[model samples]
Target: MQDIAREAGVSSKTVSRVSNGSDSVRPATRDMVLAVMDRLGYRPNFAARALKRGRFKAIGVAMFDIVATGNLLTLEGITKAASDLDYAVTITMMGKGQQRSLAAVVERMKNLPVDGVIVILEQMLPDVGTFVPPAGMEVLLVTSAQSTTMSTIDEDQYGCSTMVTNYFLDRGHRTVHFVSGPEESLDSHFREQGWIDALARRGVVAPPVIRGDWSADSGFNAGLELAHVKDCTAIYAANDNEAYGVMQGLAAAGKRVPDDVSVIGVDDVLRNLIPRLTLTSVKMNFGAVGRRAFRMVARAIEDPQRSRPTRELIPGVLVERSSVRDLTR
Candidate 1:
């Protein structure tokens, strides 16, 4: 303290005031003290700084992987938001084939000096409830991983499912079969429920539901099963990948799209835009999901005391294409 005071030609109190951004320091005196501290490479300890100001100025992000398009967009959204707010971000990438356990990641963050964490949703990974967050630390769940106290943000999966299913139903289809994702996934269940609800609304008994693991292969298998059902005139797939597989299966079985059977899926992937044979689907602004989650986490970090944990939903829009027969015509 005395050394810095001597170097800056100022008193110890002036150095303290300048370092803490207190109002008492004169402009010239503050500059002199800052210059001396810089020359001496005197960095403030973050822990001590946090104690003085009640903020760590850092946030943690835990994602399943960066390769997935949705996760990548989420990462970008988080980074952009953090940069705009002048906050430092530390991102931890989970494993490739085997998911990195949330327990281990949360433990690591607990020991670090970061203020909060934002976890990207991964259905293959186990529930996040196993990992206990640090006392007073904010944790935001960006996906459907369950947490008793964490703030959560997700797309309106059920709503999307209902919109597409109703569209098919309104077209005068006798029954619409569903190709769903894994049973364990929250989105999958919500979507399936929506399909069931839509059928119930029309006083029609819901048809048997085929489960997929959110992959093209599963959709293909489910499609083959649907082809044999003579009454199956319409199909609703979980995602675009599954929809593509369903198309292949229908073609191999000598059935034409919209002519023989109509189809609808969710997630408007880039490849779905190809004009040759456009697959009608429900479009989701995944980037918005990421941005909303990031903002929620940021807000939670800033107002840890006054903010209450909340769950936010992003809506989806149905994109009409040639995949459906337009039975009304």
Candidate 2:
């Protein structure tokens, strides 16, 4: 630090600030200090720093799968947020056998060099019990896993589904059919509950749900079946992949979108595809969920004794496009 400070002609405090990623130093000063450090091959010893501060300045992210688009976006948000705070991130995937218990699964992350952990639920069993992290370890849950007693930061699955259903109903569609994610998924559970609740609010009977595995193929299969239902004029799929598949199936069955039937879905992640169809979908902010989850976990790390919120729901919005028809007009 002294050598770099002298080389950069800045006080040791200025060098320290730049090295610690503090923004208080001017850009020019920070740059000069960084250049000096690079020339001197001076890399801060993270191990020593962690020992001195009693914190790793790193976080662990545990997930079932990151291949899914929403999960992938959430991870990106978390990593970016961690970077901004000058913290490092370590990631691990939960094993299927570990699904027996949330705490057991989380215990796997204890060996990781992170100050805290963020468990991202994907296929968390509905019956999985409460998660109690190892003593002195802070943890947060992200996404849908209603079974756990752990604090969670979830995307508004119920609200998104309810909003989409109500949009169809308000547009004069008497009732709406739903294509739901797999039953084991908490996201699917909340979304299905919302769809039914929304219909009941309007005194309309909620139709039987068509279950899908969060895949376009399952959605395509559901679409084929829905084609024959006489009153199934509006459909809300659980996700964009399934929604796109549903549209294709509807097309195959000679059911023109927004004409013979209209369809809307969640996770506008794929709204760009099927350019002609242009799905009117709800936009899920998984990235925001990730950012917020990271921030929440960081706070826990900062003050382990502070109170933590039980849950936080990040709401999404509707992006109207061509797929849904305004029947009232």
After aligning candidate 2 to the native by TM-score, how far in Å is the CA of 238 from where it should be?
0.6
Highest TM-score against the true fold, candidate? 2
Kindly list the per-residue Cα lDDT of model 1 for residues 59-98, writing each as its tens digit: 8888765776566776778777777776778887666654
Kindly report which residue pairs in candidate 2 clash with one another. none
Task: State TM-scores per candidate.
Answer: 0.78, 0.87
lDDT of 1 at 247: 79
Q: RMSD of model 2, in Å? A: 3.2
Q: How far is 46's C-alpha from truth in model 2 (Å)? A: 1.5
Consecutive 10-residue window with the lowest summed lDDT within model 1: 123-132
